[model samples]
Target: MGEVNRRRFLERMTALTATAVATPATLGAIANAGSRFPGETRAGSRAAAGRPDELKLPPAGRPQPAELTELTLAEAARLLRDGDVGAVELVEAYLARIGRWDARYQAFNTVVSRDALEAARTADRTRGRAPLTGVPLAIKDNYFTAGVRTTANSFIFEDFVPDFDATSWARLRDAGAILLGKTQMGPLATTAASTPTGERTTANAWAPHHDDVSPGGSSSGSATAVAARMAASSTGTQTGGSITNPSNAQGLTGIKPTMGRVSLHGILPLTYTRDHPGPLARDAVDAALMLQIMAGPDPADPRSLGLPPVPDYLGAVREDAGALTHPERGGAVRIGVLPGFLDEPEPPEDPAPDPDPDIDRIGSSFPRRERTQAAYRREVATVEARRRMLATLEEMGAEIVALDFPTHWEALTSFNFNNVRLPERSEIFLEHLRDDVRKFGVSLAPWINGLLLPAAEYVRGSRARLVLLREVLDEVFARCDLVTQTAPFPFDMVGLPLIGFPIGFETGSTGYPRPIGGMFGAEPYAEHHLLAVIAAYQRATDWHLRRPADPGELRPAEGNGGGPRGGAGGSAGRDRSPGRYDLFDVMERGE
Candidate 1:
């Protein structure tokens, strides 16, 4: 092992020993639990010995082309399988929807309708038995697809096309999935979708006319596409909170699987060790199915080397959505709730009011306090909504445990977090920095910060990460089946699995409903547990079923363009403060 790897292992061993001493019973149970590797199927894991030949279809019915766009991935696949809906018809439905709605929502950067139709025609002839066969998906722009314009929404690779598909996309494609197009993303997976000139592109499907509501970042377009029924489902890559934040913002179910769950072979790098690719679906069951197909070891990515087999993620949720809530599978699910997670975090103390940095000048036109207050109110409503949801789960015999985050959570997430990711990001995009830094636009400041970060600080931050990971695994996860109402930082740092699903909606100041999301995180390779909880929560609530109003039918308010082109909702000259989480800022200003 390299020196750094050795040190990390030693630090984890020391922390684990201390953890075992502190809570012998809890540690004993964790120890008794076999391999935590994501590839290993845990005891009672619902996955069968080999790929099952069963068709997991839902109630069969054929909706009109426009209506068919509203069906979840599994539903669409079922329709195609049962012969009630032709694959060509399904593809045509989504293509038509994208043609009408995508122009307004700006969800897709590139829509290959011709290719999708051709794939659909093939599906109709072959009638493939794969779970995702003929299902239309919007892939994040960063994921490389052979012969597709795989722009990371950046000028650097605007014309770059790959010779082979990204492992994640390849897996989905080989499973008979059809790509509708590459969805827009934050340039280099940093912020909201914007042009080389810094104009915003995508809008939240829930309220495309309301500039006040953000679609969420990096994976914003991916989430918007599915939420607006433009695609059956989509893929997203999360380096910080890219997948979870957008999934939360758009009222979709997004799973950021364990760090190495899905191979990142052909995707653009953000934070090498941090980047996680997963699916964004309309609901938990769809998310589970998409994840199952996309996850596993890939020869292209050494990080994805031998671990354990991908567990039966779809079966875990499908067989019994509420199985994790009851002890029949093992112990009744223990959900860890961090106190004050829903409340706004305490802002950093400022002794001397530092002059606002120049980067702060480039942001939205909305007043800072107004936007902050709105986000705060939304969080308050989110807390109440989640409490009610949890109450329902508890009544169903689920256990909700109050747990404190690690002692250094605030410090690690705040100051030290940036140090860990920035250096690597700087290294990855060093050429861009060396050539023309201005091209980075709003993302430039952080890139420069990473460039200037001290080597010693980076090393220290890297070492501290192992300590934090050990604490999360040994301390927090030891007692809970999942962590509820999650924050993305520490969990991202520790490389655990997180599932984001809509809990409810908070009415925005503009009288439009803004999606409020809840999350559940589990130990590495514990996606089965996370999916089980979310699937059950979704089964009990109709929040995931809520779809945004049709953008084409809605008229844009005066001064705000009806499309994503130019509007009051644009992120023009406004506050560019770093988000609540230092890793990736999708929610700080709610854009």
Candidate 2:
């Protein structure tokens, strides 16, 4: 066969078996969803009435809301446990901030102020040492929150309120974390936060004034909520880089734990094997704590069963990776770098112009040209930043190794997505597709395309996936403990764990600084490895510590404060009456 035909033949073969392996898992999940998983009865009870953890109390003193809001999750937990800050006060502080700024950012689709405050009150009154006691979190809209409107930011689910909490949220609530609200998301978690008509809803916290900037898709509002300090940290789910992309865009730390590390029982599923529910936090340590609480086996998700016990994430993060030797690697954390990922080749001189028909379609592609140039510059800067970060990691005793995967990265990722991911997503949403495809909005075409895929190709793709997974395990992972690259598809395809964190920043054309992010992928069930390395990097660098400028920093002209209320423990305003806490009313009043 000719070279092209040979390649085509292989592609055909690979696509045929894409869905064969995943069918059993999907059916098992559906079967088990109705029954309570082990300890689920206990989880359900805890979810109904949250229990707070007890710790040694320090002398009490009232801390300003702004000061309380500024502290990290770990810091805030210490304050809550030490009795220095009341849970009510902490929740009130975040609620006030959200009420003040969220109107402009549109980070939340629903802010459960009354519910959150009540939960906070419970946290204050109750006692025990669970990790997240009294911590406030912005949950992604896709996650089911019993009685709360769980719209997945879609018109189809606009009025839908789930009767049961998602397993991830239930775990957090049971551990004493207060639900701040449901952050806005891409309609059905398929694109950036936008209406069915494609009108943007959420704004990038770093550049809210610029309509051109993206907060990143699907998990956009989750990242915005954290970046704007509207909530301490937030939950995010990734089917295809949803968690990491937004976290990178907003300069936060996001971990897409191994697919089954956390159960996806109540999350709106995009793909059975690729959907990973995890945390977008201020830093790696915060991410670790949240993941620790979120990770565990659940009978509702058969994929989560048969896994080893969740590791000591906090302990792993606390260990100085720089100082301690990795037993297996025989050195510090072995980070594998793909030179192509970090080094961008120069654009070809005298590039071919757009075809004549293209020019006729759009008179001037200046907008396209401008976008391309800006992206090129951003990537250039990102390359530089990543190279610098590698140097820094080496200085901190990490061993950087150049490595390459066995399969063609681009080819394999495209095959996996088109053949495997699309089919699974289509299967999950087949009822919607058959009924009213128009409701899918920006994702309608993609959903339709999935329906058009040949069954033989999908089965072939599944067979190829098994081959790729074995190759990755035997070849790629054998060389390094972690791969230092941000493209999540390759790892997400194989169900491996990865972490995305801020490495540096570059000022955009709008003069607003945007963050540049780096990621490291680890072997399956090895989230602790990913977390430890990132925590060490965070400890050494302050990129993750940077906060976005609040668009609503200055209150209305009639308001008392002229500057940001977030600084120096200053009061933004006193808490309003319980009746006045409704976000819709607050936004309508234009306050």
The lDDT of each candidate is 0.71, 0.69
Q: How accurate is candidate 2 locally (lDDT)?
A: 0.69
Q: What does the lDDT read for residue 312 in candidate 1?
A: 63
Clashing pairs in 1: 39-308, 39-309, 40-308, 211-569, 363-574
Top lDDT hit: 1
For model 2, residues 1-591, the per-residue Cα lDDT tens digits are 000111232234332123211121121121122222223222212122211222212344444556567656765665575566778999999998888877667889999999998888888887424556788999999999999999887777889999999998998877778999998887777767766555667777776644456778778899999888888889999876788888888898999999788999999887787889999998887787688778888889999888777765655565433323563456677888765876674653344344343332111111122224456678788999998888888888888888875665556665334346677778888998889978776556556656777899877777767777787778778888888765666777777888989999897554557899888888888887888788777767878867765564322212211122122122333222111111111111100
Report model 2's TM-score to 2 decimal places.
0.80
Residue 244, candidate 2: alpha-carbon lDDT: 85
Query: Across residues 1-591, which tens digit of lDDT does each residue of candidate 1 receive?
Result: 000121233244443223211111121122122223232334444444222223322334345555667666765665565566788988888887777666667888999989999999998898876656788899999999999999888888889999999988887887778999999888788777766445667777877765556678779899999988888899998877788888998889999999888899999998888899999998877887688778888778888877666766765675444555543347678878887865654333344234344434323321123224444566578778888878877876688898887777667766346347878888999998899987676567667778887899888888888888788777787878788745675677667788888888887554567788888888788887787777777666778877776654444444322222233333222222212222224334222
Report model 1's TM-score to 2 decimal places. 0.83
